[model samples]
Target: MAIATFGLTNIHRRVDITEGGVLGMVLLLDHHFGIPPWALTTVLDAACYLLGWKVLGRDFLIRSGVATLCGAIFFRLWDATGPLLPNLSAQPLLAALLGGAFVGVGVGMVVRQGGSSGGDDALALVIAQKTGWRLSRAYLFTDLTVLGLSLTYIAPLRIVWSLVTVTVSSLLIDFVKTVGHSENRQKA
Candidate 1:
């Protein structure tokens, strides 16, 4: 959560790059409605958690709760602070790549533990279970939906850059999970 927060504060916001899934929607709503991202994140995350609990079961809820709380708290803590790292607005590609790495590694760690750092995971899992879609397909569907909506506020070129970040993050997330799972299996 801290890494993801740092990426957003130091790079994404500076580069004017938007993300997908629930975070993207939070950014969109915050931009148009003057709602704080933390508030939006909490409400939206809680809503997804509720739905996920109903669909996925209590174990899922328990697993996600901690990371969800940490995410909200971390976002709140990181909320008002200025970027601690150098601004990467002038180098958008680098910003995008770094943003992807931060999110990928951070989220992958949570996911490997059978937890979620964001509502996107629960939502995607719910969608996958209910609709019989693969988890990857569900995630892609949600990401594309949010990215498409973001087009209203974000530029086409910027969205393309966002695609790059998403692609990198997705691949890295899978890589991390796969590698971690393999290592665990080998250890066992």
Candidate 2:
């Protein structure tokens, strides 16, 4: 969670390479409405978690709640420090790769533990459970939806890189889930 948020605050935000799903929505709202992402993130995450709790049950809620709380705290702590990573505005492609790897590993670990790092994960989990789609496919669906909407404000070129980032991260998340869990062996 920390690594993912660091990449988001440091690399993605600085490089103008947005992601898909909840964080992407947060960025979108921030860009268009001048709302602080930290506040919006909390509200959005809580809403999605409530939806997820109704669908996924109590244990899932408890686990995901802890992870989400930790993720939020870490995000604020990192945000307060400002972006310490080297500027990547000139190298969007590299930023995309690094950002994807960080988020993939971080969120993947949480999902592997039967939890979610953010609202997107909870929503994706619900989507997968409800639709019988693989988790990665669910992630791609949600991500692409947000990325498509991002076309309204963000450049098409940046969306191209975001697509790459989401794809890599989605694949890696599934990869991590499949590594040690036979029940989660569905391939990306």
- Candidates' C-alpha lDDT: 0.77, 0.85
Q: How high a TM-score does candidate 2 get?
A: 0.85
Q: How accurate is candidate 1 locally (lDDT)?
A: 0.77
Itemize residue pairs with steric clashes in candidate 2: none
When summed lDDT is taken over every stretch of 10 residues in candidate 1, the lowest stretch is 179-188
Model 2 residue 148 CA deviation in Å: 0.7
Clashes of 1: 0
Could you give candidate 2's per-residue lDDT for residues 1-188 as a string of tens digits? 78777877788778878779998899888989999999998898888888888998888789987887788798899889987989987888898998888888888888888888879999998898888777889999999999998998988998999998898889788778668767575544
- Model 1 TM-score, 2 decimals: 0.78
- How does candidate 2 score on lDDT? 0.85
